[model samples]
Target: MNEHLTDPASEGPAGGWGSVKSIARIYGETLSNPAVLETLKQQNKPGGFMCVSCAWPKPANYHPFGFCENGAKATLWESTSARCKPDFWNDHTVLELRDWKDHDLEMAGRLTHPMRYDADTDRYVEVSWEEAFSGIGAVLKRLEPKEVVFYSSGHAGLEASYLYALLARLYGNNNLPQSSNMCHETTSVGLTKVIGSPVGTVVWDDLEKTDCLFFFGQNPGSNSPRFLHPLQEAKQRGAKIVTFNPVIEQGLVSFVNPQSPRQMLTGEETVISDLYLQVQSGGDVAAILGLCKVVVEADDDAKTLGLKRILDVEFIEQHTTGFDRFVDCVRTASWSDIERESGLTEPDIRRAGQIYVEAERVIGVYGMGLTQHSKGALNIAMLANLLMLRGNIGREGAGVCPVRGHSNVQGQRTVGIAEKTKLVPMDKLKELFDFDPPTEDGTHMVDAVKGLMSGHVKGFVSLGGNLLRAVPDQRDMEVAWAKQELTVMVSTKLNRSHLFPAKAAYILPCLSRSEVDDQATGNQYISIEDSFSHIHGSIGKRSPASEHLKSELAIIAGIAKATLPVNPKVTWDDWTGDYSLVRDLIEKTYPEDFAKYNERLNEPGGFYRGNAAHDRIWKTPEKKAVFTTPDQLNSLSFPDRPGRYRLLTMRSNDQFNTTIYGYSDRFRGIEGTRDVVLMCAEDIAEAGLAPGQTVRLVSDFEDGRRRELGGLVVTQHALPKGTICSYYPECNVLNAIDHHDELSKTPASKSIPVRIEAEP
Candidate 1:
């Protein structure tokens, strides 16, 4: 807090890397010895492993001063000086913590012991591990499996998530709500309809083979650092890297590679993208349609127009369906409409289209921006259709990549986390364990909140994550959470979710992947699947964040043992004491690929469990990738809500999801602030407002719900005339808790229209 020594904007533009490191640490996530040591233990090396905090997913061999500020934050968070304990929540009530800021809630520190909610005191009290597990099982056993929802987070290790999926099936609950529902649900729905699998089609190695990359709404420098090498290589090779986003992200344009010793020493940086398309929010679908139109038209004059032609007559004729209809769709779409909807003129759209046509192989990578809209699923489908037009689905360096947020978020969903997708293992479990899996699809994140509020959801056992901060409408979600009859949070830290206690609630503190895993027997190694579907072993090197902490695997096992007293075949309690037993069960219950789970995990960096993308053979009903046309192919229509501007939710460059790493957003030129709303100059004039003026966002949540948030005004970039941008979490109050995609059940986080008033 020494202002004299601080330079707010020390490493100015073109100096992104220099300022990035210290910037993130100042916000709630500071790096420490604990983080450094745990990273080292991942490699079982002397120096240290690269931090996965921000985007530090660099190659394993990337040893030369690799990692960014956010990555450092992650490492520090993993190996924090703070400790979780039973008493952590003793002084705070569910109501009290509900009033705390998101960062302040997490800043309380990691969870250290098992806890239970005391209805009389309205506080979380320390409890014996044995008591917690027994209570969890007894409550779960009493409820209809249909009424109990098991929510999993990406933070859960392979063993913990595996056990959760197994237990859910054993108890017969299809309500396996997950962190994925909030993040990549669109990718799952969209990719499955087109390619038969809800995973990225490209491998980590395939980044080298790509001739071009369409980076859609991904902030790699802030979110995922590991891909820097591949992106840098693509840039060096002249591969056309085009970025489409509402804000012109500086990280996507250029970033310094901390791994490059020469670059760091000389203060040099690498340019990332060749083209920057500031597509208005929710305009991705339109922008993509524009490209499709150009490709279909350019086919006629490929040579003269110098277009990257993609007729692919032979492939389209044999491999895909609805090509004729799709082509017609492109032709009927006029340039004026495309320009109006996309906010990019004919030349920019053409230029983007030219890059697509010129490259034989194209990879489309996206983040939450493409997944959090009303038509998010369709947006994904549009990308798939566009890729299919050019035969890009199965080709090398030509596929879709959804850069996942949390470490094992995708892996958890892939292995077992599913409330809806009929898992084959559930039937297999009934046959093996003699319990019928629940038939009804259970609650999603938003649905769970509603169910809790309605008193239909009696109990919740979350394996990981802070559900309170992560969900939409904190005010409503907290109210709903308080209504639950029983809530059990199996966690690594103390957070707001614990505050939403029921008559019986528990916060079971557990080990972090960045630290060594241990049960009664010995140390254990956990597994995580990366964005590229690479399953790597992550072992913690640091001492426990808290000595009283238990691994998530152990706690779940305790619950299983406590709940299923009549289980004849399994010794759930015995396995609860040791994680390796959990891993063994995982290898047995799922695919055979995880058979050599332990030994293979220690083999340097780790290996893949096999992505269907590798062989170009999909797992569709036809044994070939299939394309699906949505029952409706219409774009979003802003209904006549008088005086309302198109309000889009945005993550400040300094923040990630609900995790506020800092208040400063270096990218958009905002610093020491998180409350500012980004607006166009015309809107500032139209509203008769000045740059630094304060305003209130008046929202119309279709169900007659309304909210007002105040913030400073920022008039900078050229946003589409009707569109306005504001930070998420702050603006989450505007979103309707009941509104979401009927299928994916993802909250409409990106496109909610609102009206701005002068702090009324």
Candidate 2:
């Protein structure tokens, strides 16, 4: 829809004129449709709706305007006046709608009623909510409990996600795969292995006190705009902010706060990164090890000079294990190996290490770029090791911060939305609910896909999310999913997944985050946890998108009640009527953190879920943080072949995970299309290609299989010579479900071996 061409050189700088353009874009929609203003009024306010965007923690004193550009876009799109009513579907077929772009499908607006796909007519027909539920129940009842897969989204509130998980467990299955699989599973699995806790140790307040902030594979300006404020504050305090990423993102280079009048009027931008290092794709491990090597060498030299050693000897001796083995690894690491793998100079690595050595307090912030790889878990461990060198964890102003996506992604996991861990303890479940919850480990996202392909999994009930579109190897996944006996999607808007249904499919419409949930008792509010582990309540004041629409909580209850015979102990109806009952259940389930959940949620900004890592208390068997020594070298080796390069998939500035706000990436200076690949100028020249030439990307698999993506525009960028970059979903074809992190089982989306060929 963004028809104008963008300058191909590069994204200039974030904030300044770029932010102004974003604000103007929002007003263009708000002035034309006033409903957007209504949504903005409730966002991030006390006792109002939460922003259905990133999982960044709310400021102690919340922003008066209450949102950033991306937040505004999310609100405006959700609050649109347009609607995909029943008649609209009568004129369009699923096959036809499948051809539309993701943005166009979103522009079709909110779904107003339940609809069932008609195979004969190839269209979706309006159906009552009862009929839809009964139909789904009938199909599910005939299948084995293990045959069904319940997929949840991070966007869903705590009540709905918990109920969905409960329904799956009650139905005798543990195949509870949520969106965390594709996004933060590495953070969860990896961090737990290292420190025995998955969540970040640092709180929002830590940013203000940190003397040095290291950002690896994260772009905060676009992904988490609220973080820019603290980074700016840290800059003013003379704190050094260093960045290590494959691309030198414009957001990290500079930012202009739209809240400031002078900045808004005059384009005065604040430079963000004190040092920006463009590490190669899948090269973060090498870069970090190189920095660690410098630190070890410096400490050794200091010891020889009879000076104070840089390493935290006291902390390491008392609170950690396997340090000697890790030290041996770091000491033996060669500069040539690191330089070749990271594509960074020895001086650059030393400079970053020197900054860390001088800073008294430091924070390490990372994003998906570090997590979506075959060695993702090791990547997380490397970060932990770097911070641990100076005893940064568990101290004020210093710790590991894994930047997350979604509003309640961390919350969903907290309230029992996991596959492996049965946190609810079977004894507790029996005592409280009188139901024998299943204890067997179930499938994760990647395994779920394998189950579907093998015909072992036949039924799917999505509480939210466009799973089919969001997954890797879209074409094969789509074909495999079509063989299912039944598929049900509970969504507020129609996404690509709804179009490709199983043998029997249904789309159940639900209320948006900005709409009030008028339940049997009265209006209800649900709580969500932010990335910083703060649990807060969100109350939507706007009316429902449609009268027939139901709350996600009610829908889960309806489906559960329809599928299973009436039971007294579960109290599905009672929990749906009043969300407080759900909170009471959650409190009993996870008493360690959620005890007195309702009472604490009533507080001004909610309560913090105390992290064990924050108190320097390791939950491992050894009761100490252990240094992880990876089996493989920190750097990956590539075969000597012509035209080979590593492709890293990422999101555009105007997009969230799998949800495209628009085709243009305003911060990246990419407009009019997303069908472009960013390659280094040196590689472009080596390949004998021009700056704006067209190419077909072919992914090289270790198994000798190849995946080709055609018609991608090749644009020259300042990327590391061996690596290239492209937007996801469009480039998802290059990813295979089997290509994933061994420990976390996260699809290796960020690091794919590929080569480009001239477009024929």
Candidate 3:
């Protein structure tokens, strides 16, 4: 596992030769049969299966391949030719498998049967689906409704997520702790408070028409490679793209379109960013404040300088409130404070501000780098203010775009997957489903883990994803998982979470998005919503990997029926038989938005789930977009301690969230290892450390506990002084569960105060 293969990159661009090699490597390793081709074909065709890699909006016209390299990896990982059977489990025990790597565990292949943890043998033994359901139901019925927590992930389809929420509420608990709590909870909470909606205003089509696109802490080449196509087109159309980040990500600099054979063969790359600003860790708020201050200064001197007015005075006067307070806050922010906080000079901030002043239609794009902080909500508010200052909302090519992580994460929320009771409106549930939903607010991820540790959460059910590995404080999460009285996981493949068994644990295998679900009513298809609120269907056309595997929807129905044997208020059998019935119920719940859910899926490119901000329809208490002025002084203050670096957790180019596709980060010039740290050369020299030196990272927190990780090989890069980077989940140990955004409860993975030392 410690074998390091280093081939420092010099020439090839991302998505050109690197992607071809990666795709070939995936096919070679997976040994996927020809059936995978049909799986991919259905994945590309309209109204077919949608990619579960990311929530990036699909184009009106899709590529013949219809997916990126990472998307292909996710597909191949799901549709691999390997299988983990009873024999495989008999050969290895849970404690022995604990030594396996994350990718190795995923590579163990799909689970073909329902398995239950046997404490005597310390292995998972095959069990009947009925036995698994009955055992889990026994615990569910014994515990109080509030004691059970239902966790959901973005990988689950909207239909399954809706049924999961319904089942949890019907059983009497609203403790719906979802993956969104770890990814974009800030965007969901912050944007709603500012512009009266949880999603972004602009659609995918707007990228082609935008005059200027500002990237705030987003790396498209790795996270969303397909997004690069629109960016490439926008660049060719004379759109000015500015990027703000800490590290010099290769994806933001240049890209070679893999779809184009000419560019792939010849090294003709498309330049993405016109200007790159390297801000310090957790400095987005300061950088944005400085940019806003420069914009206001330009507006003040527009007439005197013989320049056109930059700020939309009419839009501000009529469509916004608190502009006066925002302006006052920006005016008082001194350049000295901005430069110290942002690690950028006054000229650098103004230069980017000048570009913003000139563009007519602008869109601001951001990812977890901006939202995974203590001041995440305020950071989002400031970005909204920047967009609103120029009348960016209610337009075709202007608004904010929060690049979401998992596919259908947004769709799940739309169909009803939330911890807050008010977000779903219980009265509507009572009207349509005849069930009185829980009125009390449920626990989020942080609180859920706390509840599990304190014995408050007795029973746990997961729709998808490895909750233990994905959450912060890995040690504590494992302990919490063991404390649960009953734990049931509905999954397609084997993962790390299954190894951490509870007193009563069951692993129920479910069909993946690439597998056809044959229910009582022929085939069933599920729909998902993209980042831009585009609703489309994903009908799996491939055969099931194993006959024992059941559809997630069917499993949910079975569990619901088993848990409430006497209840007849809700019809789980009816919804599971025909998925359209679920859609009909969804339409009744959201009459205006999902009026013709089935008919809309039949459209050429599916239907656009209209954005309220796009139409200037604010659903806020003030009935207008509100401006927020965040305190610059209260920003994440770097400790005065010497030799401490602000370590930011990042994903390798080949990895997506917790899923490691490979060991190489081809785009970042690191190959053959995820066990390395990226830091500034100067910082290494300052600490008296040499190149390729092995070191351990010790996190500093207010709580009197030292979290340390050793055996990391250091690599020097052009990172900002006192800044370092490491891959997530591996570095997740350094992140204290309590160290999170106060407003959103999202872990501060992007900005953690740590001190590096030589491994002893």
Candidate 4:
């Protein structure tokens, strides 16, 4: 397969008529007619369903049509008219479906019936809901609690996730692992240890009042386009924007708001970044350390001159610890090492540091670029250190913001869907449910995969995600997944994971966030938390595609009722009837955070959970924020060899995490295919390769395993020399399962060492 290349759009801005056209095309393809306008209007509104795309926060005064291009794609993708019925499943065999592409499988439409894999015929047959639930429970009853792994995706709502977590604990284990383990686990672990909070301290209003916005490894234009509105407004108010990324994402260069009629008519583009430092892949740690060094040296100069000290000495002395050690570590870092690792000169680093020092209030935003590396947690800690130098945390308009991918991923963690036993309030769970919750640590994503491969884990339960398509070492995950005794997937549509069935596999259709979910009591509303830690209600307005489809909350409750013995204190049926009862239970379990959960959810723009760090009240052991130094100065170490390059995987403009929307990547000037590797012109020639040539990438690892991806077309890009980029999941084959951060266990997908060779 070869990719069709084209010059990227250099005329219009990022979100102008191009976005409008893309939205129209998706609606046309999905046959989302008459309901399109209604769905678009309701998205991100006060009483409307949350967009299932990104976790960007909804402003108090939200736009009438607040949806972005990708948001529209997600909404229509879920609300499409096409249906996958019993007939479709009967005609297609599991072995045949496994050969289909990820995009084609999802385009087959929403699952409309409960299905069970028939090993005799190698095909799926429709099964009654009761029979499916009872059969799954029978298998669960026979196996040890530790043998089953319960997984969730960001697509699940807060109500469903809370019940899912409770069901796992009540079943006598804490083996709950979800999407965050692969993405922002580093941010949560690093920030909690330093500031005593896992979530970002800044809110939506803070973006509007900030003096400087520093973006590191985050591309909001594609991942979260709604965020561009804030950046546009911030730029207009004279705020400086600095970016540190390997690729010059179009979204970061300029933007043209489709919501603004004047800019749409005039074609005027607002420039986004004042300084764009193309940092090498996995170089965030060194770059941040260089910034810290500059800040500390500037403070010394200011003190010598008897001028105002550059550091926030009062805030540092009163509210923090270990600052002296952190400063000493930064002062000792070598300038040459910083330049070589960061791929930038001292002048550029000083310019960015000067911008940081001059600003009164700054907000630092980042994404997987920093967290998907071996030094992921350390990268987050270094950024926190830089912010602390100026007393950025716990302030009105300043803090660190980690942009999450899924709409409710952060919410899922907030509601106790974690693998760590100590992360949840075990005492509260036992008191409310009248059962002794498990105390042992459970498996995370990587550990779960290892368990399956080793045959230690016998069953798999997924609330809403394609595990096989999202994780590393895809070729091995599929084989390991097939060996499970039982597999259950509760989802709205069919994906690749559903095809790789175990001895006993079932696919249960569920109501999506866009469709109305009616229970025994009345219409139901689910709550979702955004990246800003705000919780709000989402009421789906569209009609259901099938009569047999059940709500996620209902399905989870049914599974719990069948698998666990009835407890007098826990009433699954009543909670499923009315979600408010679940909220009451949540409030009782987390009195400090979820107090008045249902009442406050009705407020405009919802309510903030209020991080202790934001109020300058650290909850650490010493009751103060602490700064720590990284153990290593280098982000990555590679042997000196020719034809070696650092390969990073990214998402196309037309895709979300593993969910490919189309074949075209308009931002990168590629069209008609996704089977291509982006490389710098110099590196291409040095390797005796040229643009449009098909090449194979072989990963270099110490394990001595042969990990290669073949038949990938080469395309020219503006990346730094010795660094290459490709789309994720497709290129995940090159990422070894064990190559990840030691502390957080996030796969090092952003910085894989690989060699390119001509495809034989």
C-alpha TM-score for every candidate:
0.91, 0.97, 0.97, 0.98
Error of 1 at 228 (Å): 2.5
Clash totals, every prediction: 17, 0, 0, 0
Candidate 2 weakest lDDT stretch, 10 residues: 1-10
Residue-by-residue lDDT tens digits, candidate 1, 247-339: 656567676766566877776777677778878776887788888878887787875687654577766766666666777777787788777
Candidate 1: lDDT over CA atoms? Answer: 0.70
Query: 1 or 2: which has the higher lDDT?
Result: 2
Model 4: per-residue Cα lDDT over 503-548, one tens digit each: 9899999998878889888889999999999998899888898999
- lDDT score, candidate 4: 0.87
* Top lDDT model: 4
Q: Give the TM-score of candidate 2.
A: 0.97
Candidate 1 residue 342 Cα shift, in angstroms, is: 1.0
Q: Write the per-residue lDDT of candidate 3 for residues 1-760, one digit (tens) a residue.
A: 0012111342345678888788889888888887787677666457678888998877767778788887888888888889988778778999999899999998888889999999999999999989988888888899899888899889888788888998888888789988989979999899999999998998866787898999988888789888888888998989988888887766778889988989977879887888888888888888888889988998889967988787898999988989999999999889998888788888988989988988999999999988888778888998999988889888878899999999989988888789988889689888766667788899899999888878888888999888888988888778889878888998877888998899999999999887888888988888888888888788887888899999888899989888975556578888888999888888888877887888887454557878888899887789999999786532363453786678889988878888887887876778888888888878888888887999999988668888888889989877778779998888888988888887888988888888888985
Model 3 CA lDDT for position 539? 86
Candidate 1 at 477: error in angstroms? 1.7
Backbone steric clashes in candidate 2, count: 0
TM-score of 1: 0.91
The better-scoring model by lDDT among 3 and 4 is 4
lDDT by residue (321-422, candidate 2, tens digit) is 889999998988888988877888999988998889999999999999888888899999999999999899999999999988888988998887888755
